[model samples]
Target: MAATEGPTVAQSSPSSTPLPPGMVLGPDGKPCRTCTDWKSWSKLAKTKKAQTQQGGSGSESAGASSSSSAGSAAAAAVVTAGAGTDDTAVNATAPDDCPPDREVLGRATWTFLHTMAAYYPEKPNEREQTMMKSLLSSFSQFYPCGHCAEHLRDEMKKEPPKVASRMELAWWMCGMHNKVNTMLGKDEFDCNKLDERWRDGPSDGRCD
Candidate 1:
């Protein structure tokens, strides 16, 4: 089978040579493509021959140039794949591409959840509270990304959802998101800006 790559992997750091050797695998012992970013998965499939050719070249400048060119070409290929109707590859999309990957999907999901949380009533009646709790519980159970869902489930066990008020829920969700961000080695977002970032625009009217 001809291998196609993901968008993120098309242009990777030098430390990620050849293939992504550090990808986390599932209990099935295969790469969890849904949980793993497209870039890492794409790296794993790069041809050994091309890697050898780059390594064998003597000139550092030439190798660097070649690598950059290759990365651009890979990015283009990813863009093309994303636009096309090909179902083989996953998570290789340009800005205008189709079939969003894990990263894009995650961003979209978080946006929706945060917005929903922000709009939640400050004092929800019992029925509203129960429904909101059920929705979150269902999300943890049925999130498309299995490993992600599992992590959420485990986190929920230790720290249950705080649905007392909109502000409380938003803060609680922000904290939960930060935990995941920390796990992924991403910088923690300031919970103080949850309203500015998610609900209200920044004070400067920049968002307007």
Candidate 2:
């Protein structure tokens, strides 16, 4: 009789089975010699989980800080808006060691003067130059209103009803002065004629 063929090796199935400790099956279902040790695999998993938890905690902390910052900013704005306009009240609410009111007014006056100087057209005529100089000098002197009421009244009397309001006139003059100063500082042409046009009108004390 012919020799019987030995039993052939059975083909493994595609589905994987768990092997013993420190062993794993490859994609082909054969034992994987390169499988990581169980201890190392467990340590890696723990490290990954810990990192995820830390990341989540950090994100939460950042969100809380952002919310806190936004709340603080809003509260500050509200506080500022609630403060009244009275100079004394304003000063009291301001930070300690704030600049004196006179100093601030003086600075503002100079700023206005400088602005006017720049905006006034530089006509070669001496009258225009003199008028521009006088306007700047007047603004510099009359600002801070401590003792310049008489001079201010006189000027107001000279202006027309349409331009007489002290506050309105002051604002316009200061604005013009600021613009002139800015232009001059930037090396632009200085035109001193703008003040002359305004000065020609009858002085009315109410600008509003």
TM-score of each predicted structure versus truth: 0.64, 0.21
What are the runs in model 2 whose C-alpha is more than 4 Å off?
Answer: 1-100, 137-208
Model 1 earns a TM-score of 0.64
Tell me, by lDDT, which candidate is best. Answer: 1
Regions more than 4 Å wrong, model 1: 1-19, 22-30, 44-98
Over 30-72, each residue of candidate 2 has an lDDT whose tens digit, in order, gives: 4322232223223323333444444455465766766554554
lDDT of each: 0.65, 0.37
Q: Write the per-residue lDDT of candidate 1 for residues 124-208, one digit (tens) a residue.
A: 9889889988999999888766667877777889999989899989998998888878766789899999999988899999989
The clash numbers for all candidates, in the given order, read: 1, 24
